[model samples]
Target chain A: MSIVVTYNKLVEFGDCDPARIVWFPNYFKWIDAASRNYFTQRGVPPWHATEREFGILGTPVVDTHAQFTNTASYGDVLSIHTRITQWRKTSFVMHYEVMRDHCSIMTCIETRVFAKHVGNTPDSSHHQIKAIPVPEFIKQLCGFSQ
Target chain B: MSIVVTYNKLVEFGDCDPARIVWFPNYFKWIDAASRNYFTQRGVPPWHATEREFGILGTPVVDTHAQFTNTASYGDVLSIHTRITQWRKTSFVMHYEVMRDHCSIMTCIETRVFAKHVGNTPDSSHHQIKAIPVPEFIKQLCGFSQ
Candidate 1:
């Protein structure tokens, strides 16, 4: 288990749909931000720094499951609690719970991989990214005792 | 088997992140649109029309699972293919595939319910949304034989 990190977000007007409720996709956006906050709160450097130091470009989500428990709308203050529940060689599971005033709003789990750009085809402008092992130094930085 | 309907979208600049790639959550937004398109393509009315006719609000997402296969950036033209894979008493499952030309980008399945508003408390401004039985007329409109 990793340290719990919380990210607070204010639901904006644009985040709502014609139904006047927070669109389900916006929950995933907050979950993604909360995911990064977990690392930042643990003193892990930003992706650019990690890329320069360890060649790890960023963590890319491979699989995600989200459950919507309640509806929300703009002007609502939501708190996202995030943590890494499991760590593997190349992937980790991030769990997020979005709450509004002690009410459960949504919950999500994402499986993400630390990735690096691969293939240097001269003709292709975009390079494919491949998953890489979780860097040990970064793991220690996350305070994961192994 | 359900008839497939495709929804086209142009990836906008705002849809991308600092990495210049389309943020993953945007894919869900497109999936939601594609889900609605599946109904429209089958001659089903919009939610507002349905609400007026049947007191049904809209399909509310309860669960979703997504897998990201490839990365896409701004200015990319993408197609989302969606269809209802199964129908239950009060819920249905939608399957979506996001394709950028010939490449597979991401795929998702969502479980959603036909919902309606319930309860109007004098003190509480918010009302709870509850799932209702899948309307037979709506199912027929979606081209479901049974």
Candidate 2:
């Protein structure tokens, strides 16, 4: 399945720095929000809810890179494109491209790995933890398994 | 004089996915916060205020890259180190390293260019805008000029 989502955002004042250009870090925040929205549109509940229900942890990002091709100013309409580039047994990768007026302005690639939630514990060694396979439903949704 | 500031953060619940580790995008957020705080400690008001007084726009990021060396869980105490790396005519760079328990967990570098903020009218263009020089106060603080 080809999963693609587009979001049009006007650079808000909070999103810009003193220079009135969109803050660099805020771009990543927008991309992350768009990624979550994409999953929500696919009929998958938010990742946190999914984790709590199934005891399936999320894959935290282990690596990330971004390149800015053009400067975006306040009120610029940014179109964000997110797509899954790799889905493995224990890890997955996503690619994002932000464009303005159909021209590419930024790109990013992120890699994440599965992890288990250990409950609150004072001792670092005794925290509850376990590694489990990707859930069948999610694997199917992600097109990794039939 | 070298300036160093440490920020204590409770990894927000929203910062983690099912993986139980800090999300990649949140790393940028944390680093950005720390960097801003560093500036605050140096007596350079927040970027927003600086912009208003000097008519000097902040630099726009041209690139960012990060490597996650270790996994950081929720409620972890993360210490971020930020230092100015390059001070150029119309741009500057910052390097950041995130640590937990004395172990380096992440590193990031960002390059930003100083530019003038033209209005958001349809006729506005980046070309028509100009590059403003770094303010004299900032230059002194950054040790670029005394």
For model 2, how does the per-residue alpha-carbon lDDT over A5-124 read when each residue is reduced to its tens digit?
Answer: 777678776876555566677887787787766666666666578777876555455678889887777767899988777777766787899999978889998876555765757757
Q: What is the lDDT of candidate 1?
A: 0.86
lDDT of 2 by residue, B1-146 (tens): 44456766766667764455666767887887876676677677665676677655555566787888776777777888887777777767778889877888799888766556656678664422356765657756655543
Which candidate number would show the highest DockQ if scored against the true structure?
A: 1
Of the candidates shown, which would achieve the greatest lDDT relative to the real structure?
1
**Measured against the native two-chain assembly using Cα atoms, what DockQ does each of the candidate structures obtain, in the order listed?**
0.66, 0.40
The lDDT per prediction is 0.86, 0.70
For model 2 the local lDDT of residue A11 reads 79
lDDT of 1 by residue, B1-146 (tens): 78788999999889987665788888888888888888888877899988788767789899999999998877789999888888899899988999999998999999999988776688765646889999887788777894
Q: Give the TM-score of candidate 2 (chain A).
A: 0.82
lDDT of 1 at B72: 86
Off by over 4 Å in 2: A1-3, A42-45, A73-76, A119-139, A144-146, B1-26, B37-55, B69-76, B86-90, B118-146
Q: Evaluated on chain B only, what is the TM-score of candidate 2?
A: 0.82
